[model samples]
Target: MAKTILVVDDSASLRQVVGIALRGAGYDVIEACDGQDALNKLTGQKVHLMISDVNMPNMDGISFVKAVKQRPAYRFTPIVMLTTESQESKKAEGQAAGAKAWVVKPFRPEQMLGVVQKLVLP
Candidate 1:
């Protein structure tokens, strides 16, 4: 079966663009507008990987990652943060929250796909 990926972002355009890229790379993509929405979706679906944007309305990605990690079922799920912020502090926070990788905004499809392939199921 194809790997399932949950993509959380506030920008509709970014969600569309990334969703297309992930689908092109053979992943089944699920989208959420923000952290709370992502949590709701998580309960309803089976996801293999997560790609999230840090600064979002209503609960933000950092808090979302922490919440996901708290859940035993999602503790080890591979997560990557996609955002414009390149601050080491933000990266450190994400790492501390259990993100497996980080991708800056304006991500290339090939680069994003590479990480997805490495982290998600083959």
Candidate 2:
């Protein structure tokens, strides 16, 4: 079966782009408008990986990652922060929150796919 990836971002266009890329790479994609929406989508489902944006309206990526880590069912799920923020402090914060990788925006589809393949649960 294909790995399922949950993508959380406030931008519809960004989600669409990521969805297309993942689909093309033979992975299934679930999209959420923000952190809260992503959490709601995770109910009793198996998500192989997650890609989230750092800044959002309802909840930020770091907080979202922290929330996921607190959940026993999802604590081991790999999360990647896809955002514009490149600051060391922000990256450290994401790491502290349990994100496995960081991908800056304007990313190449190939690069994102590479990371996903490496991190997605088998």
Best by lDDT: 2
Cand. 1 Cα-lDDT = 0.91
Instruction: Return the TM-score for each candidate structure.
Output: 0.95, 0.98
Report the lDDT tens digits of candidate 2 across residue range 6-62. 999999999999999999989899999999999999997899999999999998899
Error of 2 at 59 (Å): 0.7
Tens digits of per-residue lDDT, candidate 1, 24-49, equal 88889999999999998888456899
* Positional deviation of residue 100's Cα in model 1 after best superposition, in angstroms: 0.8
Error of 2 at 50 (Å): 0.4
